[model samples]
Target: MLSWRRSTSATAPGSSLAYGCADFLGGPGARKAHVLRTVMVAAPAGLAVELLLWPVLGASFSGAPLGWGAASGAASAAAFALLHRTLAIGPMNVLSPVTALVSAALPVGVALLHGEHLGAAGLVGLPLALVAVVQVGAGHGAGVARPSRTALLLAFGAGTAIALQLIFLHQAPSDSGVAPLITGRAVSSAVTLAAAGQMHRRLGAERPAYAMSAAASVLDSLANLLFLLAARNGDLTVVAVITALYPAGAVLLARGVLAERVHRGRLIGLGTAAVAVSLLALT
Candidate 1:
């Protein structure tokens, strides 16, 4: 769960869709610690889901790649913690886009380094995707306050961490099934618990908050499971870019649930991202 201050005026458009999703999870008092705590609590539930679905999905597992999965989970936890913290403490508009761009770019770079070729369409679409991410990250309206440099750096680092997590997960063998995901959830939970302890935050006496956190955790786990499956069979570049469009879901949520106005800039960015993703798929 993540939360931040909401702007009163429509002129601001305040948080981006990513932050909007966080808002749903944590509400106005949502901060870095709360977000981490939610993730920590959700880990076990996510693991359970993976285990339950394994038999139905007919997924097989091997212990050999558990280490890789654990590593990926650790990186993912770190990324989420850092990213939520950045979002909580900084401008959502700027940080979200910066993080999204880096998250998308790194996997593509990794794919290229591994001799994965991007056809002409992919080459063109890559830049377009970057541009779209930037547009979405920038505030929805003119005259918006600029995001701090520290926030930008934090977001970038978070995105890199997420990229590493994705790359590692992609390396897992298909037969490994959701075992890596389970390993990742366990690792992330432990790390987040430690972080919560250090911060001296207690997840107590807030029933609604707990419920929201639990929901977020379940959704996040499902997302991770699906992503792992997708990356296993698809090109990492394609999967990463497509997955990076998750903020668009946040935007839609914001509009429908929060009644937030979707400005032209964001709409354009989202539309551009859709086109860019389509191009990537074709390539």
Candidate 2:
């Protein structure tokens, strides 16, 4: 079970969802070692995929995106390591709160920096993005607690990577192709796994944790791929904001599978986030 400083996230709704999925898939048990292995291999694969896709997408190919991608990737890897170490320190609700918020707003900052005018849609989504974040916090508060300093720092670092990714995506040359982006996903997955391996050894995780971590890496890559596709097809603001609902997906998974407690706050938070999404998109 993934422990936090103050919270036990093993039974967290999000955790439950993942556990249930593994059980449903009937592939393996949800042990720490398994989670770790899953994370180690799958995470970097996602990044590698993104890197390869950028060139094919016809976007202005530049090393700048890769540079920033590396930084963000490192930050994310650090975050995962921290999560493993501080599993017993904080609540899943607490740890996951601001990540999406940071991610959702990052693209807007990138667009503005690049002098892309914010449309009405952009204006609408901004506030909803905040609301959505609040919902995540409320929903996960039940068994959550304050994280260790290391966890907090890692969380911030992860947020930074996510934000940087959005900026890079926004700044990617208009003519950029999707090939490199996909390639990046695969490469990054490998990188993440290596980092996870180092951390696994440090933490001495068991088999189940390794598997879960591996699964997380793969899923995270798929999520990134979806985000890229969404960006390719939809407005940045819309795509970013909608995908920010990922934590909600994680939370929902917990409710159905882990038999974890779902707080009313989560319902309200999700509802608020939904309202924000609708308002943001419509505007």
Using lDDT as the measure, which candidate wins? Answer: 1
Candidate 2's TM-score = 0.67
lDDT by residue (tens digit), candidate 2, 1-283: 1111221111122222332243332234334344455555445544554455444444444676555444544444454555444444555455556555666677656655655554676576567666766576544344446666666665555555665665455444433345435435544556665656677656454544444445554455445444544454445655555555556665666677677676777777778766666555553
Q: Count of backbone clashes for each model?
A: 0, 105
Off-target runs (Cα >4 Å) in candidate 1 are 1-33, 58-64, 142-144, 201-208
TM-score of each: 0.82, 0.67
Off by over 4 Å in 2: 1-31, 34-36, 41-72, 82-88, 117-124, 139-151, 174-176, 196-205, 209-216, 233-235, 258-261
RMSD of 2: 9.2
CA RMSD of each candidate after superposition: 8.3, 9.2
List of clashing residue pairs for candidate 1? none
